[model samples]
Target chain A: MKSKTLVIAVREYLAAVKTKGFLVGLILMPLLMGGGVLVQSFTKGLEDPTPRTIAVLDRTPGETLWAALDTAAVKQNSGTQVLSVPKPRYTLKHIETPTDAAGLDKTRLDLSDRVRRGEVTAVVEIGPNALKPRPTTTPGTEPSEDTAEDSVYFSTNRPALLEVRDFVSRTIQTPVLAARLGQSRETIEAVSKSSRDVLASRGLARKTDTGVSFEPRSNEAATLLLPVAMVVVMLMVVLVGASPLTTNIIEEKQLRIAEVLVGSVTPFTLMLGKLLGGVATSLTLGAIYLGGAAVAARQLEVLDMLSVGLVIWFIVFTIVASMMYGALFVVAGAAATNVKEAQALMTPMMLVVVMPMFLIGPLMNEPHGTIGLAGTFFPLTAPLVTMMRLTTPPPISWWQPVAALLSSGLMTVALVWLAGRVFRAGFLLVGRPAKFRELIGWILKG
Target chain B: MDDAIAIEGVRKVFGDFVAVENLSLRVPAGKLCGFIGPNGSGKTTTLRLIMRIYAPDAGTVRVLGDSRHGPADDRVGYLPEERMLYKSMRVGEVLTYLSRLKGYKPNRIEIDQWLERLALPGVARRRVQTLSKGQTQKIQLIAVLIAKPKLVLLDEPFSGLDPVNSNVMRDAILELKNNGTTVLFSTHDMASAEELCDRIVMIYKGNKVMDGTINEIRAGHNTDTLRVRLANLASNFDNLPGVACAIAEGDHHELQLTPTADAQAILRELQQRGPVELFEIARPSLHDLFVRTVHEGAA
Candidate 1:
């Protein structure tokens, strides 16, 4: 029986690892996630030496705010090339006319041809009260009850257009503040230049205790994300990774292999073998995914924050969650009549496993607070919650996870026993799930 | 006794509906025993009970001297009526896995040898879903036989097989019996049952209706089948003195003899009209016995 179980486990592990779906997930998850981070770094890697083509639609007369706007973007260490033309090469361009009515008529005629035909980026109308918010309340009276914006209009579905609008608004708003100083253009320009330098110089001075903050973790810093990621992996291992394993068992039962195996071995053996096999299969897939993440992260710089020890946690939690869900899934898989029922069974179980993630705020607010401490202690929810706490800077005591590990070990045993009971009788069940007495009688004996 | 299988006074009731009631029977080692009955006559239910899939409500079962409910090391094999093999698994892998579960590591050479022996060598590496029903049944049979258990119980092993495959199965089963393995098969095909079974036990509606060797059963029932051909087309044997009834085929008439009379007298009279083409005496077959038994049970 022991040999058979081990054989079942090994066979299951190898078979799952060799499957196309598992292999794809194993190769693709790390590549996709790590690739996302890599893609970010690659996109971020492009140097900003070249000036940007800054297309502006300033409707204010004689470029009233252009000089001030150019200096503000320079303070942020980026360059801009100003473009103001009779007709810009984008949609939503303004066609200046002699009068407001004339302008409206011309815009009506040209808006379709220009904006719809992509002649300008946007129309910035500098009409009467164009850049001003008209006062809604008098100084001596109670405030009016309108809780809405003054006005701005643009075509729907162009979110990037807001960047252009807000830039112009900021460029114009700064001069309104500058008007009170009653300074000449040259004086305002000098002061703004001095202020921009002061801000840029201070930005470089903002790094405090950088070397010292990471120095304490220098020896074990390689693996800080390991503990946290392991917990996440633990949940994912059971929730997402066990899909095919459960499907394998369910398909067999549907195919009637349960009875065939029962004829060869004891029902108890079959139950245990299948559960262990599922666990082995799930863990094996997890290892491949973890390994891929490690390799892909090594090639790119960002993923190096996670350590080999994190991979170890992945193995441990994976084993724990695997057995836990493996036992659980065997019963569910046995009860389920088809793939849809099995999926329906798993969705709730998955939500239960991931519910702690939704409450991460409570747990992270105080890593050792009553709620966080209890979350760390509770076996079912601890793997994710405690590890979530560990990801931050509290330097959680080692005793916490040791205690959790013990409780989970004991919980796994209990769950396996209960699941074994369910698995043993559930395999023989046909039609719908039975009532209590009938279910119990199968376990007891006819 | 070291019987290959013995089910005694076994009763199984699902809720208020009894599936098997006080069923008792035995099969000696090294025999091909046919288990025959109608659809709801408890054949599959009895097989399930024998496999301990559903434990009997009362009484006990012993297979080859070991209790049926004992651990799996007991030398026994089962092929269920409903087929099940891993669809995605390579044939060799699945067979090896199942064989390992049955307490043996199947060698590829031996597995291939068996597959070739069963004329399924082409499917050894292919997935099970790609195989035809006959091919899959062949694989299933090989899987059950790979361990070479002392006893093998098959439920409708020939249900969906075409005639050729059915013949192959019959031959394999006879070979197993010759190899000293006790075989019990439940089937609805009475012709196969008649040709294959060494002994039989018939049940209906959760009760054993008849139990015996084929000859004993034929002798007990009023279903004697005669091999009598008419001497002339003008002759009518229905009104003959000793003939109870007669059924005519293309060139022959089957006559049933009256209990108190001799069939030789009728044969002599039929010989007078013209020379008889053929005449022979044979007992009624299991099909005839089955029909008579069912009619008697209803009566």
Candidate 2:
């Protein structure tokens, strides 16, 4: 009996695992993820070198202001501007020679006309008189009585408008504050120099707080892992999707082969081989996917999602899911006489699986929340939680996942026992579902 | 030696109807037994019970000694009436596969030998779906015999066979009997049953009506008959003096010689009427007796 079951299992595995589809899934999955990463990095690198050229329209002077703003960070972003229109280096091209308010009105009309026609990006009017300083109103902080006033006019251009705002708040105010405090420009220059070194560290810390980061490297990695894990969990979910009991009943009735096979082999062995075969197929595909991702990450410098912890949990949870579903499906399939009944009976199982798909966002959100903990520990939801936690890193005590794995494993064993009982009777039943009372009696009678 | 098949008081009830009730019979080893009955007369139900296709409600069936082993035992040879052969499989492959399922890997060379013995019309590579009805019948015969079990059970093996294929099957069943293989087959064709069966069990409405050798059954019924032909007529010859009872409307008289009188005396006295062209005396065959016995039993 043992040998027969092993032979059947091996045949099933070989039939599915050696197919070109399996091989393609193994090889293509990683290559695709890795390619995505490489492409993103390539685009990021390209954008890095496409220097940002900012237009200067300060009325004071170019050399002095340029020097003040030419610290390490701003210099890194400056580039040559195209020579389409002849304009001042740091002042407005159409400033009026106004001795009165009428002259200012003419100047305003001329600038407005050019702006509406989209001639220039934006106009910055800066001559100390136009600077308007708003005091910081943070609670418990006294407002500075002596403040520098400057006005910078903004245009309708989106980036240009934003740039003009940034120049006033970031560059002009800092310089003005230091001057009012009787500090030299050299002291302010040192403080700006130190801030650039800490930018990348801040970016890294921000992402660590959120495992599913949108930073080029981690987001692309998370994106790849999300689908891979989703596919794994989905395939495992098929165990629940199509119950073994349902098929067992239908097939036994169809060929009467059940009458023959059951003579020698016990029911447990039969259910075990079938469920294990499905799990084995899933594991094989999972391994292939992970291998592909690993190889691509190495060769193409892409993000790898099949971390040691992820692979372990994925295997553990998928096996549990396969066993549990195999047990449940066998009962369902065995209960059904026809395919239509089987499908109808399976709708609830579908709802059970799809409910988790909706909960996947939460699993992604809180890998160790009430939902995540429920998903991880609950036999029905754990298979997906195991993978979702990889994409959306969950926060909880480390033992939470361990406890989930152990608990679901125990539940799956119970399911295996239940499935075996269903298989023994249901596998050969060709007629209608055993009445609920009968089914329950069968469960207890044994 | 124990009978190859022995069912003692086997009773099967489906809801209210008894499919086979108190059925007790035996087919000794090496004898060809035909299970005969009308449709729904429990011949198939009895055969299925013997094959363990269905368990008897009350009684025991001993096949090759032990009854516990299922029809899947491979020691039993069975060809169901419905004729299930995998259509996608090649004829030879299916033949070999069925043989293998019965625990024998009948070599293609030997399979071809059997096919040739049955005189199969198509090549070995032909798919089963492509074969004509007669040809498929031959394949089924070979599939059962390829394993060559001690007891072979066939249900309506002659249902669709043409004259030629029918003869071919007849020869094959005879050959199995010659080789000491006990065969059990169910059929409605009384002529074939008379020709092939060494003994038969007749069932009706899930109950045993009669079971014995053809000779024993015929003698038991006693519907003895005689056939004669005459060139000229003895007017009212059907009511003639020497012929106590004559059944002839035209020129011939079919007279039943009385038990106390000799048939030769009647034939000589019939010469005055006309020169008789032909004379014969023999008991009725099993078919004649089956109807006579069943009708008489019913009355």
**Candidate 1 colliding pairs:** A90-A119, A90-A120, A90-A121, A91-A120, A92-A122, A226-A310
Q: What would the per-residue lDDT of candidate 1 be over residues B1-299, giving only the tens digit for each residue?
A: 36888888989887788888899999889988999988788888888776766667798877677665645643778899887788888899889988887888879899999888888876778998898889989889988899888888999999899989988898899999999898999988888888888888899988998788888887786534567765566567656776778888677877777776566776777777677877877677777778877888889
Q: Which candidate number maximizes DockQ?
A: 1
* lDDT of each residue in A1-446, candidate 1, tens digit only: 78877877777767776777766665555564457878887655243323222333334455444455556545533323223212111122224434465766566455544545555444443333233434566778986542212222334223455555565566655463354355555676677778785542111123356542222233243344444455555565555445565577677777888788877766667767666766776676677666765675566554635555545655676677667666667656666667777777778766766777766666545657888778778887766666666655546788887787777778878777776666666776655644556546644652
Candidate 2 residues B102-202, lDDT tens each?
56777778888887788874568998779888888788778778887888888898888888888888899899999999999898889999999999888
The residue-level lDDT of candidate 1 at B45 comes to 84
i-RMS for every candidate: 1.8, 5.5
Task: Give stretches of model 2 more than 4 Å off.
Answer: A1-216, A219-224, A231-304, A307-342, A345-358, A372-446, B69-71, B90-100, B105-117, B120-127, B133-143, B224-284, B289-299
Docking class of 1: medium
Candidate 2 local Cα displacement, residue B151, angstroms: 3.1
Report the interface RMSD that candidate 2 achieves against the true structure, in angstroms.
5.5
The whole-model lDDT of each prediction reads 0.69, 0.64
Q: Give per-residue lDDT, candidate 1, residue A282.
A: 66
**In candidate 1, what fraction of native interface contacts survive?**
0.76
DockQ score for model 2, please? 0.08
Best model per TM-score: 1
